[model samples]
Target: MFKEIIFKEDAINKPEKGRLPTSIAVLCGVTILALCTLLVGALISTQRHSEGLQQVVSSMLNKSGVENPVTAVLLNFRSYDTLLEIAVLLIVAIVMLPQATVSKSLSLIRVQQSADPGLIMSSLLRFLAPTLIIMGGYMLWTGAYSPGGAFQAGALIAGAGILIFTNVQYQVNMQSFAFRALLSIGLCIFILSGFAVALQTGQFLEYPQKYASAIILFIETAATVSIATTLLLLYLAVAGTQEEFNHDA
Candidate 1:
């Protein structure tokens, strides 16, 4: 007649895994507020100074030897900053460029994954690859007077290189001095030219007004080469370094 009944005690509410403790949440909120304040201050400062900067750039545009204000700033007025950028890329490339494995070909890059494209697709890629390189060259050449520049040229060229790489026939020799030279040429030329200018004018990278155009062209050319190769090397380091990867590992 007696049915055994089990009484269940009330369970304590558990804090959610996704929710932070109140103290931590408050701390994070305070940190975010501080960052927002700093960012707002920085924006205000930049806004206040930008008007003067634009006027200065406008006045000096002709002297910078480029029709494009952006290119003038990047490759002439503030070239050191661009040099530093390329140097950083060079460092990244050096870090990312893989050494040839014993089992792979004596090249820095190896095609770990193979693909057999249809004739039409293959022909299209081949056509596009060379076309991209030509476009990159045009971009580099036009940077002095137009909107394009070394970075744009490098990106376009890197795209072509990736297309070629994916065709499963690439075996780049990273161990070659020529390959490294191409990867570092931008930074090397930048530093050397800056020092050369300094030796003549007592200020590094202060290009003479007479030769500014030629110098900018030279630097951009070198930068395009290095930037493109470095970018490709970085992509290879990411995609080509492992067999399980979908690329040159």
Candidate 2:
């Protein structure tokens, strides 16, 4: 009986080893074919005389109430898309949060001695955190006329949050009310702005040209805060899960 069981297990494992290579080869071939098809399609499409959105964009910038074309497109021309994107990020952060029954004690604990940062890292973080915050604010401000925007700003701020949380002594409460509020504030502002515009123009998100820049700026500011908070919470949630697993082990 022991020999039969061992033979059956070996047979099962042997087939998997053979099938694994075959499956990998098939997947590789399919991926290569798909990529080639996409490249060819791109080449053919670009060769055609296609009157793209350039003309429309040129006209849009004049009435967009912003000097930056990219900003105008993101916050004005296609703002509904940006709103939806923010909602998606909020949903992801909400999903990542620990369950209500999870013990508060298990949510955060001291970093393992092996993973603790040395003096140099701690000193660097002190300088980098403030610099990142200032840079993020600058990015948000310059989004109106240059390359930076809320997304870039949010990422920088999130990086700073990550540095703070990774230090041995720091902890963030992912489930706190203030954190939740900050995470949702952007979405709230976005929805309210849409309704306000609807009240005036009978169309959702259609900002008046006179107030377009101001409205966009307000939305961007809220979005920056919400995005940063949401991302930081996500990191904390992931780190908490890992810590829980390690404790269990």
Candidate 3:
């Protein structure tokens, strides 16, 4: 019953009236029109005023004290937009982690014995998970002063999660709200910290010179946590599971 719903065969009964050449021509026409529209929009948008805006941005960034100009703009002058961007990221995480529908046909399949992974995979994953997680931490911590940041760290940490999911018995699912909340907390903390900074100083996200490094550190830590959790959740959403948990065994 649920199989019919979950695995619907749409193409089997669907009408197929178009010839290959006609379909190809229609697709090419749409692509060409889209490219032309984009070209025209770009040409019209970048005028004299746009150049003035660019100069203003360059001047402001030039005066900023941050080592990374992009970070300075994102976390300082345009902080309000950054807040909304964080919110959007949280929303995307939430949307991606919804409960999956169970298929009845899948339930009918019997479990068969496969080659045992035994102690080797378990030991390897146990060793690798911590190592990768530590690497991620290091990457996040040095982002402000060095080459890595939250995204890079998160990706590294997610590699560990994938290893665990594939080689170990545990499985994380998109429908799990606890996991989603863990992912969202980092972004929430960041936004709240920014707001707190605003309260302390009249300007939004204006960190005092005395605590500049500390504030950036805190924000980066939060970003690292959130990014790692979100990426882990993304991996789980893509990697489905059917194994039952056996706590007593």
Q: Which candidate is the best by TM-score?
A: 2
After superposition, the stretches of candidate 2 with alpha carbons farther than 4 Å from their true spots are 1-19, 22-31, 34-42, 101-117, 241-249
**Candidate 1 residue lDDT tens string, 102-206:** 333344555533556557757978789889999999998888777899999999999888777656555565656677889989999989999887877789999
By summed lDDT, which 10 consecutive residues of candidate 2 come out lowest? 1-10
Q: Pick the candidate with the highest lDDT.
A: 2
Model 2 C-alpha lDDT versus the unseen true structure: 0.82
Candidate 2 per-residue C-alpha lDDT over 93-161 given as tens digits, one digit per residue, 9 for 90 to 100: 888877654344444433454555789878989899999999999999999999999999999999998
TM-score order, best first, reads 2, 1, 3
- C-alpha RMSD between model 3 and the true structure: 7.9
Error of 2 at 181 (Å): 0.2
How big is the positional error of residue 136 in model 1, measured in Å on the Cα after superposition?
Answer: 1.0
Question: What is the C-alpha lDDT profile of model 3 across 1-249, one tens digit per residue?
Answer: 012332345545544454357777799889999999999999899664546455665676534445555555666567577667767777777787645553322322222234345788879987999999999988877665557766688789878877876664554533444555667776777777877777877776776655666676677677667777777767656664533321211
Runs of candidate 3 exceeding 4 Å displacement: 1-19, 22-65, 100-127, 173-180, 242-249
What are the lDDT scores of the predictions, listed in order? 0.80, 0.82, 0.65
TM-score of each: 0.73, 0.78, 0.65
Flag the better candidate by TM-score, 1 or 2.
2
Residue 34 accuracy (lDDT) in model 2: 100
